[model samples]
Target: MGTMAFGRSGASTAGWTRRRARFAGTAHWLLVPALAFTLALVVFPFGYTFWLSLNDYQFGHAARFNFGENYAALLHDAVFWQGLGTTFFLYFLSLALQLVLGTYVGLLLNRRLHGQTVARTILMSPFMMPSVVIGMMWLVILDPSLGAANYILSLLGLPPSQWLASPGLVVPVIALIDTWQWTPFVALIVVGGLQALPIEPFEAAFIDGATRWQAFRYVTLPMLRPTLLTAAILRSVDLLRFFDIIYITTQGGPGNASTTLNIYAYRRGFEFFDIGYASAIMIALMALVAIVVLALMRLRRSL
Candidate 1:
C-alpha cells in the first residue's frame, strides 16, 4: 500500500511540472509579435540609411552603388574635418561647464531654503524651453545693437562686443547658452540622487568632526559617482548631435565658424544634395557616439 501511494504522488508531481513548462513556453511565444514589431521599427530605418550610404543617392536621381566612394570623399573633405573639430570643442567645453554649474546648483537646490519650490520651478524654465526658442531668446538678448546684453555691458563701462556674429565668440557664446538651458536638467538629476542617498554616511561624517567641504569631497562625491556618470552620458549624447540651436542662432555663420558635424551633414544632404556623402558622415558620427556611450556604459557597470 505504501509503495502504491508513493508511485501515485510521483506521477502527479511530474504532471504539474510539465503543465507549468508548457504554460511558460506559450507565454514566451505570445511575445513574438511585439518583439517583431519593435525590431521592424528600429532595424528597417537603420538598414535603409546604411544602404543609402553605399550608393550615389541624389535626390530624385538614380542611385548607383559606388561601394566606398562616399566615405572616401568625406575623408578628403577639409570642411568635414573642420566641422568635426568644432563638434569636439563644443562638446567638451559645454560638458565641463554643465557638470560644474549643475552640481553647484544641485547642491543649492538640495538644501532646505526659503521658497525652494518656487526656486526650482524658476530654475527649470530655461531647460523647459524649446531649443529653437532658446536660440531666438538669446539672439535677441545678445544682439550687438539694441540688445540687453550689450546694454548691460555698456552700463558697466565695457565696450559692447558682438556676441554671435564674431567668429571667436560664436562657439563660446553658443556653449554658454547651451549651459544656461541644460544645466538645470543635470541639477535635477543630481538633486534626486542626493535625496535618495542614505543618511547614515552623512550623519556619521558630521559626528567625526568633518567640515562640510571635507564631507562633500570625501563622502558625497564618492557616493554620487554613478549619478554623475549618468548625467555625463545624457549630456554627451545630445551635445554630439546638437543642431537646432546652433542652426537657428549662428546658421554656421562667419564662414563655418560654428558649423558642427550635424549642420555640415544637413548642408551636404539637403542643401548640397549629396545624399550619399551625407549618409557617410551620419554613419561615422553614429559610430563615434556609439563608442563613447558604450565606454561610459561599461564604466558605469564596472563601478
Candidate 2:
C-alpha cells in the first residue's frame, strides 16, 4: 500500500509540472500570431516598396533592377525638381499666413464679447466641409468672369483678372483656399489653448502699466508658444502630404505651375505607370517629411 501511494504521488507531481509548461508554451505560440500579422501587413509591404524603388518596374515587359538609376534620373528631371520647389514654397507661405491670421482670430473669439459663440460656429463650419466640396465651392466663387470675387472687383472699377487660369496665380489661389479652409482649425486650437492659460501673468502685466500690445508681447506670446508650435507642427505634417485640394482644383496643372511633389508622384505612378520611379520619389518624400517632423519635435522640446 505504501509503495502504491508513492507511485501515485509521483505521477500527480509530474502531471502538474506538465500543465504549467503547456500553459507557457501556449502563451509563446500566441505571440507568434501577432508577430506574423505585423510582418505580413506593415513590414512586408514597406520592404516591397523599398525593393521596387531599386528597380525599373513598369506596367508591362521585363522589369530591370536598375540600382540608384531612378534617383539619379530624378536629379535631371526638371519637372520633378520644379514640383518639389513649388510644394515647399506653398507650404511655407500658407503656414505663415495661417498662423498669424488664425492666432488673431482666436484672440478675438476668446474675448468676452456679444455673439462670440455664433461667430465661432460660423467660422468653424468651413473646416467641417469636405476638401473636394470646398474646392468646388471656391471654383465658383473665384470664377474670373462671373464669380463673386471678380464681380466685386469689377464694381470697384478694377480689371477682372484670371484668378486660377494664369499659372502665376494658380498656386496663390490654392493657398488662399487652403487658408480659408484650415485657418479656423488653427484658430479653434489656439482659442482652447488660450482659455487654459493662467491669468496671473496677464494681470501682473496690466498692473505694471503694460499696454495691451506690451502685455501680449511679453506675457501672452510667451505662454502661447507651445500651443503655436504644436499647431504649426501638425499643420506642417498635413501640408507636406497635401493632395486633396490640389487634386480637386488644379490637377497640378496649367503647365505644372501648381504641381507639388505629391502630385508629381501621382503623375509618375498612375498617369505614366512608372511604378519604380514613383516608388523612389515616394521614399524620398517620406524621408524628407520624417526629417522635418524630427526637427520640429526637437525645436518644440528646446522651447
Give the lowest summed-lDDT range of ten residues in model 1.
42-51
For residues 1-303, write the lDDT of model 2, one tens digit per residue: 898899998898899889889989998998998999999998898788888888999977567999789999999999989988888888898898899999999999999999988999999999899998998888888888768989998889998888878899888888889999999999998999899999999888998999999998988888999899999999998888789988987789888998888899989989999999998888888877888889988988998
Segments of candidate 1 deviating more than 4 angstroms: 1-17
* Per-residue lDDT of candidate 1, residues 149-201 (tens digit): 99999999999999998999999899999999999999999998899999999
- Structural similarity to truth (TM-score) of each candidate: 0.93, 0.86
C-alpha RMSD of candidate 2? 6.9
Root-mean-square deviation per candidate? 2.2, 6.9
Leading candidate by TM-score: 1
TM-score of predicted structure 2? 0.86
The TM-score measured for candidate 1 stands at 0.93
